[model samples]
Target: MNASDQNALVIEGGNQLKGEITPQGAKNEALQILCAVLLTEEKVTIHNIPDIRDVNQLISLLEDLGVEIHKIGDNSYAFQAKEIDITYLQSEEYKAKASSLRGSIMTLGPLLARYKYAKIPKPGGDKIGRRRLDTHFLGFEKLGAKFNYNSDHKYFEIDAHDLRGTYILLDEPSVTGTANVIMAAVLAKGTTTLYNAACEPYIQQLCRMLTSMGAKITGAGSNLLKIEGVEQLSGTTHTMLPDMIEIGSFIGLAAMTQSEITIKNARIDELGLIPDIFKRLGIQMEFRNDDIFIPEQEHYEIDRFIDGSILTVADGPWPLFTPDLLSIVLVVATQARGTVLIHQKMFESRLFFVDKLIDMGAQIILCDPHRANVIGLDRQIPLRGIKMTSPDIRAGVALLIAALSAKGTSTIYNAEQIDRGYQYIDKRLQALGANISRI
Candidate 1:
């Protein structure tokens, strides 16, 4: 879905949303898992898959490569790719559309590792900043992969027949860059050591999936990853990690509306530093085993630093607050008690959406393209919800968070942006007792 599928979301503000909402599987993790099917010749079962646009597009690409896919159950898929004919993917239309998604570019590493050749067009995604594919190419080249490029096209020629693993230190800890390298190194001839790797939950899930397929990997969930190549890969089953971004979004939604809600099966362990990040904003939460419950509260105050300095919430590699959820945090910060700095070092233009929040009557200082200083309104005057539109995936959810907290009805156009990352957002928020509807 694109702009044509745009819907008017009428959010009746000022009501406490109350109920339990469970997060779907991770979108980034599911994308990497889907690409793993190209590695082996056996049947593979992937569980807890998120039904989103990127995943659907990759599945379509897999089918076009002669992979037999069956939906076994809800959020579950059975994949059998005994043979892949890369010749079928040589068409410009297919390559262009396939590479339009960031996740689609990950297919290149796996395809080249297994087939020794892959034709991938320039990748496309949200126009938030300069997202480079050089990191991916650099990592692949370290593993003996050669590349050919033209003004309109790029193809990798990897001789996996003599592929040798080597040490690769990425220029940046790019998520897709790390994923591409991990997939390629899994079947290389020797051991590979990756430092400065993206150790997010999605990367950990990818490592776990590869381990289950008989590849030797260690130091998952950390910045360093060790991979020992195997002669062949046997297909196996692996489930996706819970989406922490979705969990944080719901937490913000509940806070904005003064709602009491529970996020069930939230996989708190995987969200190592996230809870404390929100805690800095003084948003209260109670953990009932695996569920995170937000109690009904009148107001949440932002906690200042020990030196009486303004609060600073920044994103880093894994075990830090994810950059993907920084926008939601910025929105939440706008409603808190004191001032806070929302720093998004990864994406330059992610903080530009603060203008929309300001339009809704929030006090925020746009520090730059990558940072914003949000002064909490403390509910002095409830946000006057107004007409708005979603800009990107994370910003879209942030806009929804702001709208739900506003005083009047709000319409968010291009809601498909939100749908790309979060699954069944409307139905799930409704179950949490939000007065939100789509027109």
Candidate 2:
């Protein structure tokens, strides 16, 4: 955290917020789709784009590559990549900006497929754990791209004279890796089959946008995806889905704060397992068409198994509970009426933030790096506000929830971490009666 990042959020807790709010555009999805803009020479207009640090950094990177970007609206933009300067990627300044965001890694596929070569610096984003790019590199290698690592430059260089698609089975369901492989395979010479692929809604949205740009892809929402290489891709307009993670965060916030809140245009059908997972934590939500209405409740009891065992909330790949929301869920469970184990199976360092919650008076047993058991307070005890640092994006929001529900004022340092994913979060929460001020 630098001088700019020294900004903190001061929150007055114990407020019952009541209002309706809509989630911003999907940040993860925008990262992938924006990289896809490099595939076409024509203009691509993307709507519902979130105004955040990561997305803005990526858009700046696009500009450095000579992509003509015009802001059509506050949340819309038009991009044209007809005059890409791939050599700019090798500059020190460009490398620094590229390395500032993890999403910059996605640019590898589009660069390799279009320019036949790409140089990417090691990516930087929320230091949650070791996020490997091996799946992406290996996937590109399967599609006939040669890879080399320059230890001196601390970057990876890939080149492909002829990219011919083939069968690829990823070692893990890496979302960004899947998007990279799909983007590269879409412009290859032959058909591609990807098994054990990440099928998150973001990936599905990326595939749909690619399909609109003239790519042939099947089995979008499933782990197995088949893509037939096309000679060229045309530009097309794409509208992103609401950020499901933010929606889940808001749902958890409403429940933990005992507020009556409604999330508008939630796209409930696409939010697989998210609502049910919250419902398990004792959140009662009603779906009205596309919105979710969560009313104020005095008590919410965690559901137990039919065998009377404590329920465990674990994260897995898509169609399962998203790992991103596990932190939020863990925070919400602190106010519930029963005990539930939070198993964060994906990232190792994610559950380490439980120490912050425990310091704030929540009863949490940190079993290991991968799991924690949270015993609900049942609203019998109000959490005392305490100063803490924001660890990562999801965990930052979780801490914000804890701060809002705490008995007194709490200051959260490293506000930039929260700004990376959320758009004007403090102002948005303030609209709903949250006593938060960004300092």
Candidate 3:
């Protein structure tokens, strides 16, 4: 939070987001790659990095620990972490920035692997639900890492005398959990295989980056991964994959406002099933050499099955509609001409943000903590904008979609919520020809 009397964003609604936009690099991927710098005392270069708040904060922490960070160019950084000082890590300023990121807990794995010890505080992120660290702890324990947690706000330590690799199975396919174990196991004493691990694009990118740096890893982008531990790893230059979530957000923005949009370098193959999922909401897209073009459609209708059955959009581990973009899909579903069921199978409280949409005149029935039924009005009555506050990253983007397509002006307090994940959201939306400004 920057020091100020009070600064908030005021948005005048009913302006469609038109024109072309390219997504910044993947935030999730950048976090993992940045932490990989601790694997060895070598210079690593990360290209196509997103200049978001989280990335900047993590870069600051890395530099504070004696890592030589140089901004080679825009969205590109070179890091050489030859030494680290954990005693200087206890500073409140660094700790606050470090703990503010959800992926900060991942530092434990790399620190333990290199220094044989790591003491990181409980990390913080969107308060959508309970993001537990039990999986992370259990995964490290399997790799010969011991943990001691003291709630007195001091002396939480993890020590590994020798990392003996073992077969580890995640209770749930947690993205960060898989990343942590992989980071720790890459420099372990033996071969490590992870089953039931999260294999999202972000996780796959991390695996690829590790492999490029001389870590022998297989089965990336799949449930099972085999990593051959190495005594040391060397630096390498790697580019992050395009952000599918940002692509989905732009798709939603275009559809909600009935505008055409083209996303450059979209990595259509990496999208897997996202294209077909958006098609269900009457959002048509054209693929052109790693680019996705969403054409303007006057008639938006949710496509029913051949049997005229109600369409159901559900999220799962992978090869399914991602939980990350479910909120954006739900907002688009609100304007389509039909009914759809959104089933959020992963998190419990993720769907609760729909209440704000209902207030904006969208018809949505909350089935429970994990499900919602949305009945689109087909733009019968224009949504009236109302002042609101951003709850989380995805939900904030959804609200922005709602407000941008609504009738009157809307003010979203705490614009910082959106800043945490997306880099320069308003400016990017403006680049897409959207009439949006931050106050």
> Which candidate has the highest TM-score of all?
2
Q: Compute the lDDT of residue 38 as modeled in candidate 3.
A: 85
Candidate 1 or 2, higher TM-score?
Answer: 2
Candidate 2 local lDDT, 58-96, one digit each (tens): 999999999999999989999999999978977999889
Q: Quantify all predictions' global Cα lDDT against the true fold.
A: 0.84, 0.94, 0.85
TM-score of each: 0.96, 0.99, 0.96
lDDT of 3 by residue, 39-127 (tens): 87889998999988787878887888778889999999989989888776667766676667776777788887888888776788887
Off by over 4 Å in 2: 1-5
lDDT of 1 by residue, 304-357 (tens): 889998888998877777888899889988878899998898889888878888
Ranking by lDDT: 2, 3, 1
- List residue ranges in candidate 3 displaced over 4 A: 1-7
Against the true structure, candidate 3 reaches a TM-score of: 0.96
